[model samples]
Target: VAQHRANVRLWWTRSSLKEHTAGLSNANIPLFFPKLECIDNANQSHLHRLEAVVAAKCVRPGASLRSIGAADVRGLCGGWLYFRQRGGSPAGATFCKEGTCRMGCTSSAEERAALARSKQIEKNLKEDGIQAAKDIKLLLLGAGESGKSTIVKQMKIIHESGFTPEDHKQYRPVVYSNTIQSLVAILRSMPNLGISYGNNEREIDGKMVFDVIQRMEDTEPFSEELLAAMKRLWTDSGVQECFGRSNEYQLNDSAKYFLDDLDRLGAKDYQPTEQDILRTRVKTTGIVEVHFSFKNLNFKLFDVGGQRSERKKWIHCFEDVTAIIFCVAMSEYDQVLHEDETTNRMQESLKLFDSICNNKWFTDTSIILFLNKKDLFEDKIRKSPLTICFPEYAGAQEYGEAAAYIQAQFEAKNKSTTKEIYCHMTCATDTHNIQFVFDAVTDVIIANNLRNCGLY
Candidate 1:
């Protein structure tokens, strides 16, 4: 008898839900809508009406609750429970009596949690912005094309999230310009070097090639035909003779790689890869600041042009500088300055280093020397002896020995008793090499800062 009573009660509840949902055919009706009317039944008491409403919420097959979402179910149960606790209605009417159910419906907890997290993130970002404004400053000083800009770029790659595809696209034209400039420089300098093709009859061809290159401007975009002409000229005997004596001219380090890929670079839709961007040379005339954070410390790196003409601007940027990274092109020993062909490039770097080291203003500053372009130096040392440039000293043909000898030459210039020069061999184009050097540099700067503060 008890089981039969329970079955009958459940049937009545499901039947009521079906009728409320318009016979279950209108199941798409929003769950919050007033599906249950509170018109007093002729034979049912207030308690029975409330009980039927509660029983309708049960998860039975015929119950319309199956069509509603879980959130709506929660709202329904919460609203019914709240209504029941308030003693329901006196006219045998309960929840949703005259209007839509509004109780138990509130903002989602997930949304509220997300809002809180957003606020905290905003606060942290504000704090970080303030910190970045007052970051430690470091200046990169080196002669033109000595890889100072490359080191700055490597810093961005290591700590500033690296180059994107967009950066690659932007650098395509710059790489092409670098390639053209190098070929032009080689062509222009061939006559001065007393190099030529085998016979006197072909001298007119060399003159034509030189005039074509001289007329072409680095600022202008290269035409495909011009690119093909350059490729053809690159293989010509006269151009080959100039290339063989490349160390005599101020050619870019990237000239060889780009010259070899003239066909690809000449393509209308050429895109520069990351390595090409790294090797691409664009002389920095003004100070370019790159900001990045590492080890909870913010850093502002300044890359300025290394030419003698740009050195006057260096004095203005010395304020609050944490450290100085002086880059020396190790392979430049055999080359001369682009500005004055009479001055040896390595000698220029040494003289500049001497002046900077002796400057009383930088006496307290930590000096880190980057003997840059190790790859080119290694290759150059094997082909041409280092003794040719520094005839006073005798050294082995080995790369390490030559690099070490050159490193010592720069270190010997430090006049400050307090400032010990730290040195590292670097190939700025290589990210892994730069990362390792920068990691050590960070430690060196931090330790020096602590020592100055008497906190070490």
Candidate 2:
């Protein structure tokens, strides 16, 4: 009976040992169960229990053998068994392996150090998450020629290092193109307007201007013959009349500005001025991202094409945006869309704004309305009637009432009572105006974001 009892005890010890070491591979035995000359047969049960605790603490789910370190084993084994024997929790307890049972061992320093490191790693992760949440993402959206791209340029000038020499050089061709294209558009519109050229002799000059438009490469500079023709045609009372009635047709806002300065534009060595860069028009085709730091806050402004065909790409940029800057050409109230002359431009802007302001993707996003091109709008309001776009208007044809009515038109598009549209009257070509408006905009953005975070 004594022999059988001894045999049962030995079998029980072997079973516990196998169960504890089951997770350790043959190659990792030395790594975790290093040779402990201090351990003896008397403490073999304690060793098995310590091994179980070490396996439980150090063998993480996805941890490989190489990631398991000796310090980790030491950290786990330091005081685990002493606490287990006393029916106490092993947490923050130290074990002594000096051939006797001792609690609160000195080797627990490693465990405390590992705990400190874990806390620091957790702290760093939290800080990174906070920073990511604070980043401001702005989406620029509106109808084409609404001055969205010009706002992007203003940001570059204000925040980034102003344009380089290469930038001036690049815009030189664009300025020339604007100058030539504006003249050709005027000449083409004359026939439709039933207006004759001021000079019957200058009809040949108009033909020369048309030829330049057909064959001129983007990089090609204006020839003296073409310059002379544009000057003569621009001076023609007939062309001037057509230009005054430009709202009836599609002409760039910069056409009059560039045509008036043909001499400087056609000079032998001309570099684009800051104002020239501001006025130059280039259609935004795809997504454009501009980053800047303002008021200690990082900003990422995204400019997407506002045309119907280009708007399909706007969805890809909808994710993670902080706000939307919806630009509307205030002057376009009297004009028609380039795509469809039958469709009024201001009405198109309203429809587009209504679609996005209440979109599912931007239900919580802030909307900023930019009533842009105030300079043109003010000038045109004095001459062209606002009744062309808003025939229901009975107010005086002055700037204040006209401007307020335009702002209200856009504001009425927001169907969400919970969402407020922050509106600004902006002249995109005026740096001071844009700078002042953006400062106010930054304040609103920061305040809204803080309120959303429950920090207000």
Q: Per-residue lDDT for 338-406 in model 1, tens only?
A: 779888889988999998877766878888999999998998898888876678768789898899899
lDDT per model, in order?
0.67, 0.74
Model 1 spans > 4 angstroms off: 1-134, 198-224, 306-317
Q: For each candidate, what TM-score against the reference?
A: 0.66, 0.73
**TM-score quality measure for candidate 2:** 0.73
Number of the predicted model whose lDDT against the real structure is largest: 2
Q: What is the number of residue pairs that collide in model 1?
A: 0
Error of 1 at 55 (Å): 78
lDDT at 151 for candidate 1?
Answer: 89
* Alpha-carbon deviation at 176 in model 1, angstroms: 1.9
lDDT of 2 by residue, 1-456 (tens): 222222212211221222334465534644334322213345456454444323323432222222334444444344223323234443443334432235434544656564344334334434443564467899999999999999999999999897999999999999988888888888899899999987898889988877776776535777888788778889999999998889889898999889899899889998899999999988887678899998888999988874457555556557557889999999988888888989999999999999888787888899999999998988888989999999999999989999999889889988889999999999999999999999999988887776553344
